[model samples]
Target: MTLEEQKEIQQLKQWLMQSQHQAVISGCNDILRRTREDMRVSQHILKEVLYLKAVAYRLLADVNSAIETLNELISYFPDYARAFQELGYCYLASDRKRAAHSFYQATRFNPALLTAWLQLEKMYKADNQSQALALCQQQIAFLTSLPRALLGATDLMHEGQLHKAEQVCRQFLASNEHHPEAMMLLAEIGIQLKVYSDAEFLLESCVTLYPDNDRAAAAYQNLLSKLGKFPDAVSVAKKRLQYAPESFTVKVGLAHALVGVGELEQAIDIYRELLSENEDRPAVWVALGHALKAKGDTREAVNAYERAIVFADDFGDAYWSLANTKTYRFSDELLAKMILLVDAEATKLDDEIHICFALGKGFEDSADPTRAFAYYERGNRRKKRTLQFDIAKTEKALQAQQQAFTKGCFNKTQGCQAADPIFIVGLPRAGSTLLEQILASHSQVDGTMELHDILGIASSLSHQATPYPLNVSALSNETLSKLGEQYLRQTRAYRQGAPFFIDKMPNNFIHIGLIKKILPNAKIIDARRNPMDCCFSGFKQLFGEGQEFSYSLNDIGRYYNAYEKLMDHWHSVLPGEILTVQHEEVLDDLEAQVKRILAFCGLTFEEACLAFHKTKRVIKTPSSEQVRQPIYKTGMGQWKPFESYLDELKDVLPARS
Candidate 1:
């Protein structure tokens, strides 16, 4: 409200943070009394004041008083995670059994509660509950991966306060120089800031300093995998397994590494074994589903996903996995259950978002567009609140790419002559995966996952003061060729024995200039779709990672416009260097479009390309199931049913090309 009132709130928060519990309780009570008479304080501020009072009571060992205060606080704010956690602490001080339930509630509302995870882990271990203990371990992995200081910083990082989090983490590491968790946290911050070299160094040093920290080692291995160092990742996983053969975490790591190296059958075998050992592990079931789906066993994959749902009905990933199948229709009973869960306040936000999107698909399939649009909008709105995607920053970055990658810029530097890479780049849900499938079906083209080599290169390039394309201007010819070589070497593990490979990373549309400069002879395919259909499809899908722009209709439209303008620029400056594959054209005439794509890639027409639907492979994108089926025109205007809710998006889109 007033500046003085704001200052008072900040002072109260600072006192509470500093553990002046009694002082905070007294101060907050005085404010509450004055605000009650003045009627100036907001409800949210009042709630926070009460919450701090409850925390202070709990810290002072007044368990009953804390419980009463927390109950009152939660009556008004049922979704407050910290209040729930404090309730757990108070109950634990009295009765362990009740504490366990309270802790469960805390974690149920906020899965990121590290303290609750650790408490659950201890409670389960004491009760000799192996399955529950294992689940707790999974949750604790994230908490144990970071030091206390970094753990405290994660909230700030997630809130998009990156610089503040980085400063806090760095300050901790300054004194505790050898803290691996703090180093790893800094590495994570570096990644968020798009500085790959710094992140890599921090992770490597973390592993070197603390070899026994499996989480740090795993983080290092994961960083390697993200950078397309599949062979190195496999080596790291295997090394860990050699020491702790019984560690399920290491076994899972090995399985993931095997998948990265294109050992799909072996990965499936490992996942199956893990499931045999612990059938109650929902995460393992989800992993099995992914491996089976990648291996082209659609029936088994669906069964695995269903098994996960049976084990943990509230797990959002399981429901989203089933929805991502595209071909799987939710039963009427399942739809009703999902609707109930989506409406439940106790359901975790992540799980609720997944259930909402799944319900949207379910309603759409049942021909209930009104309900479907409501669910879709609800899910998108919920997710948009959690994201920190800045429209201005995205626009500026895209504009920098256009300005930096002029014809003269590319002509000044030449890349390697390696033409093995065939990139399918465009917005998500734009049929990029389908185009990749057709190309991968060719005898000479090995279909790989949406490899992150280009993004990794872009991140490495963005290590300077400026981001991405702006930093590209300072790179020399030697650096460009080296980057091209690095991409080829890093991606080697994903390839079979084929001479060419497909990298179907959709967001690579932003890095077309970098792609051209580093690998001048590489083939580039721009997968184009109807703007309404593509953006609407993305709005409905819940991606496991990345694609922050799809969470809101305005952001989605802004991204699509930026993508369209960038693609137009690429076409203008690099004429005849890129092929545009329109999704509607393929649906209209599959054979003709397939032949045209083959001709552009310098490959002869083959029946396999026309029958790409039958060429089964591991498809990781949202369009995974769609690409496994023959072309159809039904998806062309699927956005029409939801057009009434898309006026804001329509206002931002250009006229249909």
Candidate 2:
């Protein structure tokens, strides 16, 4: 809103407080009329004006008008807790059931609504609902026990005023330093802001100082898992289990951590045991499906996913999991059911996006490219709205890396001489995993899941004043060696006594400079694919996490452009230090490309590498199923059918070489 509009809103609120009901209503209506056509007016400003108008109508005894105003407000902001609370007040005298339901919804969205809880408690007591009354009392007591500042911060956080909440939390911590709850709240804010290092430090300190604080420990474990520190996450989960041996949530968390650490068997056992105790949990079924898929049990994984859908047909993740297998084809009946769910108004945004992608895949398999592209575009558009990707920021960061990592920078550093790691770096869906599979089939090579240790190291350095690619030029030789050693030590858990192991993180393309400075002996492979095929494939896929650039066609195109520019810079500065493996070239002659890859990594050619599809190691990527079979030319030029709709992507991508 403009400054004058904001000032007018303040005046409306003041009039409402002074019981000038008619004046407040008239003023709000005027503001709404003036800004109705203004696209610049924010949703926040509109919500404030409508809410104020509703309050004024309520005070003026215009019950019908008040309800109408609130209903209108809710149409735009359905999750507005205060509007629901006000509706509860409007219905309190004439409709007890509606009032109770409205109050319940208010608290459901924002648990800090004390008045709603109090009203619910009173109503439940009057209705002789002993269980509900007791629950209400419990919530009220817990909320009342919190410090006032912390409570206000919690409320603000729930209302999406994260910066204001962070300010309140910091102020509270300023006076009440070491307060576990305050520290945890601030850490949560940090996590939401994507400041992982600060969040980790705060949570770690909170858990260290308050060992008995299970909440802090749980939060710390979650952050560790998010950062892909699976070993550390597993340790934290075990400690939490020690504290709460019988806790179902903690057990489930430990199982997830075990899965992350590649202890699939143990994780599956825990999941089964949990299901035996509580068989109706669809989320558990989905998690079990993922573990089974990673364990190379595709048939059993499909069954597990189907079971989840049987329980909750609207469960989009389960359906998406089935599609993500890249081998599963949806039946007409299943596609119809997914279509219904996608059209359902009650389906959540997350579930809708997943189902859209699944439906896109389903249609694509059925040879309906037009319909498939429609759903893919729908999913990408919706997903992009939810993400905070900035193509310009990404381009600038790559450009900075180009400017920072020069030939002279590499000349001064003596990095760790360990030749254990072979880094596979590129955009997602670009056959990096295929290369990893080929190399991993060799007897001397161990294939690990996309390890995040290098990214973690880069993240830590980015938090330093100098930041990543630039920071590399400032590191001493000893520091570089230690950083390399730290990566090896961290990734050792994923290795099984191989002379060489593969770290096939595709986005690690952006961190080649860091890898060079730390592990100078490490072999780097740039997995390349046709721009159209790779970008379109990424647009169709729904990643579990990260790869935010893939949600939009334009973003993915620009990202690929930046990636190519940076890779060109790398080649120019460090000639013969990196190998580029084109997917099409590998498709034309798998054996020849496999020999070239093995040779680059200083390994002798092996027959097993040629028969990579027959290798029985666990594969975790979406290409897991496709890679298990012999080479096929079907994936080549798959984007041609959707070419008419890909002009935006084509406009930004580098011209075909």
Model 2 agreement with the true structure over 89-179: per-residue lDDT tens digits: 9889889998898888788868988999999999999999999999999999989999999999988877777899999999999999999
TM-score of 2: 0.87
In model 2, the number of clashes is: 0
TM-scores of the candidates are: 0.83, 0.87
lDDT of each: 0.84, 0.89
* Cα lDDT tens digits for candidate 1, 231-277: 88999898788778999999999998888777888898898888888
Model 2: residues with Cα > 4 Å off, grouped in runs: 1-141, 158-160, 654-657
Task: Show the lowest summed lDDT stretch of 10 residues, model 1.
Answer: 152-161
Residue 135 of model 1, lDDT score? 83
Clashing pairs in 1: none
